[model samples]
Target: MEAGKHDRGRSGASIPGRFVAEAGLTVPRTVLIVSPYFPPSNLACVHRARHLANHLPAAGWTPIILCVDDRFYEQDPDPLLGSLVSPELEIVRVPALHARMTRRFGIGDLSLRAWSALSSRAADLLSARRIDAVLITGSPFYPMLMSRWIEPKFGVPVVLDFQDPWVSAWGADQKPLSKAGLSHQLALRLEGPALRKARFVTSVSTRQNEELAARHSWLDASRMAALPIGGDPGDLDLLRAMPDIRRSRLDPAMINLSYVGTALPRSHGLFRVLFKGLAEMRARQPGLAARLRLHFIGTSNQANDSETFSILPLAEAEGVADLVAEIPRRLAYAEALGLMARSHGLLLVGSDEAHYTASKIYPALLTKRPYLSLFHRLSSAHALLAAAGGGIHFSFTDANGLAGLPQDIAAGLERLALDPASLGQPRQDHLEPFSARAIAGSYAAIFDGLR
Candidate 1:
């Protein structure tokens, strides 16, 4: 139970290691993981990756990470991801290639899109190393394209860990270079033969599993599985112990709703609607508006600047601009969870990019914090929260048929406040199952089935 000892000798009835032990899968099923963003990357996807990689060792599957060195990514390197690894788990950070490090955020075929060769070269390292299955986490689905080529040539099985549904799911939200677009079409066309040939496909949610199954009708469809992001029991305990935002709690009866991600542009962004709705609600319900305060817990850097998202002027216009507070990324994770423990609920904004997975919701579950989701109706994050057995969900289209907008949202908050089961009550089923050990166990099952 120290800093890195999340998995002591196996606990009973868990998924990740238990499944592996039951199947008699022993050390070194050998998985080579390709993640463009790894530890020190600090993006939320690595939480799940680190969790899965750390736990599967008990089942005897060795996970090796192949990631772009953080020096190459747009943000400063966060050394945290590497800390999540247990000594027994093998890991590798591929050195920076010419364009890969320089072209972190470029959207189209310009920089990030054209950097496939960089990943291709890095993937070749797998040949010298021992690897049984190729595992890939995507969203720079660009690198996984390299896996398609490398796995086939190297004779390794492939498992695509989809943090978000790629291609079609993004297409549903009208993303640039979509499955309908020529460039994305090219990636998919080249990827199809490689994709169909893979042993298994997995995801963080059923919404995405279904999206993949629909697009790849020729594949067995059942190969897709859901290994959701789970809360670390350690993080849960640590967060409950974290100091309350003393000033935030001092405000009389204020509802501290939290959002824990980077800001993005206005097109499909939920912060825009959230602020506007709060403004409208203020005009109608003075008490609720005045009682609400939003504490955002991720750095708003030059990269996710609010000016580009048009949040500044809109926020000012709504007279609720000051409600947005920024916290550093390093302290953000645990502090945000701590705030969720003390607050009435959490709030999430959709990114301009669709198929973007919001890691905010999972931690909310951990804290037993109910949340109000203001996302596009079809968003995987929204779908998961609505059906995940707790919380209130509202979408741009009233997609879940939750009545009217500001009125619907205001009423929803009132309902959450009134429900004896929701307010300040702990989550009976906290998200421990999504633990890395649990996830690695999930993969071991698929591995045993396929192997």
Candidate 2:
């Protein structure tokens, strides 16, 4: 029922009823959204973020976003995506120094100038504003920690969006800043205490949530929500029905197994194993290499940055020659999904060492295309695909004690080659919940509650 109706109550004409109705409609709480990446910066960073800020007011809370200006990020800002934000809410953009610092230093690590300036700016912003609540996105977790500095100054409730498993995210062979460890002490100094004081904590997935919950017991599980990274409906609309590249005459009879997203240096060895397996395919079926298109969607630091910047040479040495094509980030997603639908199969790689989840796995589901995943056997991707009954997976580490890495990939490819026809059909039931609007509504609900 609509509020503020002229209802007949026991007290005739219901004057008090009108007053009660007026009292029921409370003013929307102004929420401050702290994020480093907002689109059309087009960084694959925040799928959940845009949804939250754009949908929040619809759910009742007023979103006041404080983020790095898109122009500051070394990329063109999409006015179209920015238009999604309601003019009713305030969006505060501060030009950041990180991107420039990254261009100078070759990586997006903390710069003393950038770090000090932002930390100070964040403190100043908090001090000047009256925010009912603050939702901080981690990455530049530094900005989130600003809440700690200003929380005492202004008693505002804060939410820490630790979107990924931090601290534990040290790359393999990247020695801990310290062992016994002053660096461990210092690194934790940045993330620890601020998160400890947070009113609530959230991560993108249940696995990430468990990792956080294991450390901070005060994080209410009820408050925890799996904010699955989402694809734009516009992105999804790009999903097109195309003939299997392996089946089509234009592509020729070749197995096109595509992997979208970065094949980081640490993870390159895993793909190397697959490449080695392809070598086997080459040895047995000589023409397989010509037909085999192992498309790597998204830029590599090697391609995008360059460095000790190894992996490509190593991949070539292993014999997956001319196989690795590093496509630009812009064409990776929706186009890749369509490619997945038409390719013989999609290959998913995750860390077998850690209980990691690949964000690319979800988009593959939308394709109705079968994916062959290699990583931890019990991964969520494997489970989701198994439930949908359209994907296959095995642990590369477990099968051959990591010995048959490439050979295993080759063997798996051969197996997939056996049945080029996949049970390709959209899992509409599964896709329904993941629709951008649905996810956006849940975000709206979270924002509504904040009000």
Candidate 3:
């Protein structure tokens, strides 16, 4: 069988009968989307795959999602997110192996344990149905490695979607072979074969695609594509239906600034600088600082862990503990969006890594609430915010260098709080390309081209 060729079934066609006629439309192809995170599991990794699974049918392709059973995730499931899945979509939930003993060695996740089950299930699906393409998305990057196993045996073209860099250099500046660095090294060795075998590679940002391409000369530039994980309208719909939860929680007199999402190791430096700047601002103008409430919702050092990490201690050390509210627990996706919408302003903090693109940017913009974005000047987020306008950009380092970082962030915060109108309305044209529906169209085009 050819790499892109599909075997014809008894009907003398390459597509399965189930996908043939849906609502009077002929769905010509089926793409198996394999990911550990999907609806009910509200991990950030789930959104892109969920969006594609939800919207792909409109583009002449039916998405059959292969995801881990809900028991695999430690986080509370968001049943509301399940509404995003189309009734026509086929979701295969495979049970994962979870041994609590393996966690100390960093091998607890279902991605590692479910490989055997995943591979078996995938092979069965390919044999039973005329799956036109296989798309594996990641963070639990091992799923991408399945391409090496699937492509050769089934002769299906696999497309690897990278939501985050597989081999990250986020904290490699000082310690070249740090724990993360060593993990990245292992990933580099494992990813080589899968990347080479993949029909095409898609990343959330252009910089990530270029970086991956540069690292692998065997990968053609044309084979790499940038597909951002834009916001889903369904998320907004659910959020809009919920009561104004923020009204009861937040002080009406204060200027509320909310940051929703986890704080990874790469973002420690940015948070340090932010807290210090907030402290300095408080010292300079205590009255103004009293009016500001910085809320960190769904922000934690680790997922599903109850322990509070460095952020709270750092805030205390910087003397802004009184001004900061740290909600270490993760919120439901809709609740988080509603919180962002109700805030006086939104806060976006990117990692020091140059390729870091805050996936939250789209939803943040969609909130229509003014945002203050702080990121490394070299990061993709910097360019995105600059291009979109309506947001204040504070560089991690300035002309005066690190010494001026605190003042710069402080000034940006003041501007965001005092002159909210200056941020203006986000241009809808700039946001259209990042919509989940629009992104699915791009993926459909790639799948079509490969066929």
- RMSD to the true structure for each prediction, in A, is 6.8, 9.0, 5.5
- The model with the greatest TM-score is 3
Q: Give me the runs in candidate 1 sitting further than 4 Å from their true place.
A: 1-27, 80-82, 98-130, 168-188, 236-254, 262-277, 283-285, 297-307, 310-344, 349-357, 374-390, 393-403, 414-426, 430-433
Tens digits of lDDT, candidate 1, 27-124: 34567666666666666666766776676667666666666555555555543334445555544544444455344543432125335434544456
TM-score of 3: 0.88
TM-score of 1: 0.73
lDDT of 2 by residue, 1-451 (tens): 1111111223432111101123667344566777766655444555556666555554555566566655556544544454444344455555545456555754453323245545555566567754567788766466666656555667776777765555555432455554424434555667667776676666666777776777667767877777666544455544443323523321535567777676654466566666677778778876666667766655351223423323456568876667655454433233445666677777887765444667677667666566667775555655555555555665643646555556666666766666646544446676666565676567555644543
Q: What lDDT would candidate 3 get against the real structure?
A: 0.79
**lDDT of each prediction vs. the true structure?**
0.58, 0.58, 0.79
Q: What is the lDDT, from 0 to 100, of the residue 67 in candidate 3?
A: 77
Instruction: Provide the TM-score for each candidate, comma-separated.
Output: 0.73, 0.74, 0.88
Clashes of 2: 4
Expressed as tens digits, the lDDT of each residue in 152-255 for candidate 3 is 78888999999998877752343546766677677778878779779999998888888888788788988889888987756778775666644565777889
Q: Whose TM-score is higher: candidate 2's or candidate 3's?
A: 3
